[model samples]
Structures are given as C-alpha cells and as structure tokens.
Target: MPRLEPGQPAPAWNLPTADGGRLSLSDLAGRKVVVYVYPAAMTPGCTTQACDFRDNEAVFAQHGYAVVGVSPDPVEKLATFVEKESLTFPLVSDEGKEMLTAYGAYGEKQNYGRTVVGVIRSTFVLDEEGKVEVAKYNVRAKGHVASLAKQLGISL
Candidate 1:
C-alpha cells in the first residue's frame, strides 16, 4: 500500500456525507483539514474516535482546522452514527473504497497478530495548500484526536 507522506499533496475527493450533503476536498481549500479514516461507524473504537474529534472540534476550528471523517459505511449508517453520537463533523461514505485506497487507509493490516486485509485506521493533516502536514497510519482510536492536536501544536 502506498501511504501519503508529509509534504505530499492530498488526493482530491468528492464524497457523499451523512447529512445528505456532498463534501469535496477542494471545498475546504485554503484551510487546514484533518481527514481521519476508520474501519466502520458506530463500532466501539470508531465511536470513541469520532466522539473525540467531535468533542475537540472547537479547538480545531479555533486553530483554523476542519475535521472530516471517512469510512466505507453507507450514508444511512453514517447518518445514524452522527445522530447517535451527536457528531459535529462531517462523515463521508467511501463505499467504493477508492478514496480509502488512494490515502492508503485500505489494504493489508495486522489485526491481533494476524495479517488481514481491511481498513487501516489512519489520519492525515493537510496544510492550507492541500499538502499533507502529517500522516499517521495504524492509529489507536481512543485519545487519537488529543494526540493529533498536541502534535499539531494546538492547545487542548
């Protein structure tokens, strides 16, 4: 799998969101964006991560950063997830797995010491110019947003 690297331009994307809306990477141009990919929506780990981002969304916005979540789940599932968790950010559906593959978030991964092919939890921070500022793969769900915020020098 080819993973994104710091300074690499982020791949363009236009995907359906949980809110019955469409979001494109270009739509957020000129602003920093945090694109996080997870295995599924509403699951334990995914829920924790989504809630973490939702909780810290203000801090990110205050720092001029927007958060977007990506997963293979359908729009309906994502919608339910958003409502159930009261998520503040947009969660895009990548049922085709094209975007996930482009970002190297899909493919082979180690699951409980076993090699498996599936979504690899990942996150990427894009600069204002759309170049990747940071890329982290195989990230843990809990406390991930906190760790990312600190890494990006955002206070809280």
Candidate 2:
C-alpha cells in the first residue's frame, strides 16, 4: 500500500454503507470528510473506537465534517454494529477491501505476537476539496477521537 501524506488528494471509492446505501467519494466532494478505517466490526478495540466517534459526532458535524467508518465486514454486520452502538454516522462495508487498499488502510501487522496482514486502524481528514488535511495511521483505539478533536480544535 502506498502511504498517503497530508495535502494529497484522497482516492476515490464507492462502497456500501451499513444502511444499505451506496457512498461514493464524489458524494463527499464538497464536504469535509473524516474517513476512519478499522480492521473489523464488533471487536472491543473497534467498538471503542467507533463509540468515541459516535459520542463526538455532533462536534464533528459542527466542525463541518462528515464521519464515515470503513471495515471489511459485510453491510449486514456493519448494520448490526451501528444499531448496537447507536452510531449515527455512516459505516461503510469494505468487504472487498478495495477502499481499504486505496486508502492504505489494509496491510501487514503484528497481532498477538504473530505477524499478519490485516487492516490497520487509521483516520483521514479531508477538506471540502477532497485534499487530505490529516492522516493518522496505526492509531490506538483509546481516546483517539478525542485526540483528533483536540487536533482539530473542536471543544467537546
């Protein structure tokens, strides 16, 4: 996977959302987008990360950002997760991993003392023009959204 840096144009993609909606990169063209890529759905770490975003959703909207979470889970699973977590944002299904690859979110990593290839937790903040303003990869699940909020200067 190629490492995307800040100021790079975010790659275009079309993926299925948990609500049975299809989301294309062009759909977010004129809006600020926060694309969060995670390994799977329903896991503890992923759940914590997603819940943080869920909790801070309004703050993100107030800051003119649209939040989208991407994972390799199927839409049905994603839907269940969203419903369970009461997540209001879009949860994209990257079952084919194309979106994850394009965003450099899928790759090899160490898991439980074993080296394996998998989706790396990452976040991309894109401007209204689709240029990446912030790229955070290999992030810890705890307090990450709050950290991102701080980085964006969003109070609460």
Candidate 3:
C-alpha cells in the first residue's frame, strides 16, 4: 500500500471499540477527526502519547475535532489501557490490522535496533469532509501531541 498523503481521502475503516461498539471513519464525517495509530497499548511511549491526547482533549474538541486512538489490540486490552490512563477518547480495537493496512500504518518498524513488522506510529488529521489535512507518519510516540498542537496553532 502507498503511504497516505495530505489532500488524499483518508481510507475509511471500521473497528470494534473498547465499549463493544463499532467505530467507522465514515461515521465521523462532517467533523474533523484525529486518528492516532499506535503500535500497542500499555507501552510506555504509547501511554505517554495517549495521555497527552487525553490531557489536551478539550482543546481538540474546542476546535471541533474528535480524537480516536487505534492499535492492534483486543477490546479488553484497550479497555484496560483506557481505565489505567483515564483516557476519555475512543480506543478503537484494530486486532486484525485491516484498518492499519488500509491506512498504511502497519509496516516495518525499528524496535530495539531490530527491524520488525509492526504498526508504525502515525497520526492523520482529517478535515470535516474526510479529506486528509495532515498525514504524519513514522512519528515518535512521545511528544507527538505537543508537536501536532503546535503545528495546528492550538494554544494547548
């Protein structure tokens, strides 16, 4: 799959959420959406990234953006991660990697100095029309939210 680029229509995906509900990208149409794809849940870097988004959730909402975190984890694991971090955003369970592949978020990753197949830490900021406003791939799991906020001129 080709890497997603800005101005391209974001690949529509559906995944089971932590609350046993299905979350589809199309359902979020007419609203700006932040799709942060992480490698896994409960990892330190992932945790920090998720917490940052949670902390600045209000700022995102004030800008008419809905945030969703996606990972190749089961619903139960996502629930535990959410409860542990007190995250208020939707945690989409992409256990099958269908959404990940569609969005080009799953691929080779350097882990512990070894190249391995894994989910690439990435974020896609979609506009109200479902067009990709920003497609930031290969992002570091830490301090990414701050960078995104700064890029968007969000005061938070």
In terms of lDDT, which candidate is strongest?
1
Worst 10 residues of 1 by lDDT: 143-152
Residue 31 of candidate 3: its Cα lDDT? 96
TM-scores for candidates 1 onward, in order: 0.98, 0.96, 0.96
Candidate 3 — what's its lDDT?
0.92
> What lDDT score belongs to each candidate, Candidate 1 first?
0.96, 0.91, 0.92
lDDT of 1 by residue, 1-156 (tens): 899999899999999999999999999999999999999998999999999999999999999999999999999999999999999999999999999999999999999999999999999999999999999999999989889998999988
Off by over 4 Å in 3: none
Candidate 1 ranges beyond 4 A from true positions: none
For candidate 3, the C-alpha RMSD (Å) to the true structure equals 1.0
Q: Best-fitting candidate, measured by TM-score? A: 1
Compute the lDDT of residue 106 as modeled in candidate 2: 88
Instruction: Give the per-residue lDDT digits (tens) of candidate 3, residues 70-102.
Output: 999999999999999999999999888988988
- Give the per-residue lDDT digits (tens) of candidate 2, residues 1-156: 697799999999999889998998899899999999988899999999999999889989998999999999999999999899999899988888988888888888778899889998999999999999999999999989989989999987
Clashing pairs in 1: none
